[model samples]
Target: MRNDRTIKWLILLIPTLTIGLWEYIRHAFLLPYLSMELGNLLAPFIVLAVTLTLVRSLFARLEQSQQALQREKGTNAALEERERLARELHDGISQSLFLLAVKLDVLDEMKIDGPVKELATGLRETVRVMHEDVRQAIANLRLPPSPAAAAWVVPLRELLGETAEMSEAQADFSWSIPDVSLSDKEKVELHACLREALINVRKHANATKVLVVGEADGFGGFRCAVEDDGKGFSGDPLQSPGRFGLRMVRDRATAMGWNFLAERRGDWTIVELRKQGGAAS
Candidate 1:
């Protein structure tokens, strides 16, 4: 309504000012010629020029204002999305995980058969995965992109150590992440890839050790390798339903625009990732 009023005023002023200017010009300069018909003809061109200039200026300002408004709208939308995801994580998955934890604690106290215990353990792990997914979603929504120099080695090492201690199988783990930090996106993607690899080892590997190596690329990117000493598959991972872990890693790498490879080496399975460019700081 305010804009409409301003436009209306501008429209009214254009003709008023044009007529006033023409009368002044006629009295001031064209009075020597003293021809009313000549002033009438020139009057229209003056009014046209003035009107065009004012309209152009008004449109330019309106375009700038619109662009600014659009940018603000986008920012608000992003913030609202973050808040919604956070609320979902707290209300839904957090409560579910807490309930699962209580059930697992109860199972630990019960005198159950080996098969029943194993099934309980599997259910617990599934619930844990759901918890991790919710936490990741919340982090992605709430946290700003990590700086390029953010170090991921310490956290990765700690996570690997904790996983090894928690798993029942005899396992050995090694890593060589550089002393530098990774961006938030890189950290998230790398964690997802590593988690999938570890899950595969726990479920299907039937062997002992996992090795991880990471290094910084000269072009501000990074490369990582995850190798497991297990009974390796003989078929193409892309075509095998049993090779879901490899497919998941590949999909994650592809989504992040990174290079991914999974192949069997002798009796071992190797998965590699190469990020092409630095993520946002």
Candidate 2:
């Protein structure tokens, strides 16, 4: 509405200003014999030009404002969803998982058959893993979609450390992140892909040690690698059954415009992800 009023005023003033300027030039600067014909002929064209310029400027500003509003709307929606997810995980899954783990621990203490006791122990271990996963989910939800590298580094290392301990494997984590910006989607996919890789190690790789490395490209990109000393794939991991998790990771990397590679180098199985178009720091 404001823009419309400004445009309307501009349109009304264009002719008035053009006519006045013409009359001033004709009467104040010219001889008495000067013809008003030229002034009359050019005044409308001058008015039209001025009107077009003003209209274009107004529309440009309007378009810019519209774009800014849309961006703000998107940001708000994303934040609201993040908060909702955080609350649900904390109040629902996290609490339930914690209670379940406690119950399993109590079951383990009961006097039962050897096999039943073993089963209870196993169940408790599984519950512990599930509880950790729930806690990680809650953490992710609590953090902003695009958080500082430092904010994620400690949590990621702890997650890997826990997974290694569960699998009875040694874990080494190295991170050298430069101050580069990553979009929320990119960060989420990156973390998911790395988690999947580590999961593969924990499930299949009879490895004793795992190495995880991460580094930012310093120009708005980053890379991650998870390497394990395990019995590597013979041919193609992607073609094997029960490898759907890695396939999902590959798809996510592709969607995010990141390079993904999983292969065996000698005795080590390596999975790597690098953001496209990002130069090394």
Q: Which ten residues in a row have the lowest lDDT in candidate 2?
A: 145-154
Tell me the lDDT of model 2 at 172.
95
Candidate 1, residue 64: Cα displacement in angstroms equals: 1.4
Q: What are the runs in model 1 whose C-alpha is more than 4 Å off?
A: 1-16, 51-54, 144-234, 238-281
Superposition error at 19 for model 2 (Å): 6.9
lDDT of each: 0.72, 0.77
TM-score of each: 0.53, 0.63
* Candidate number with greatest TM-score: 2
TM-score of 2: 0.63
**lDDT per residue (tens digit) for residues 85-199 in model 1:** 7988888878879888898989978999789999888888777766775675676568643334544444455455544554543444444445345655677788889767766
Give the per-residue lDDT digits (tens) of candidate 2, residues 68-142.
Answer: 889888988988898898889888988987888778777866778788888887777666766767677777777
Best by lDDT: 2
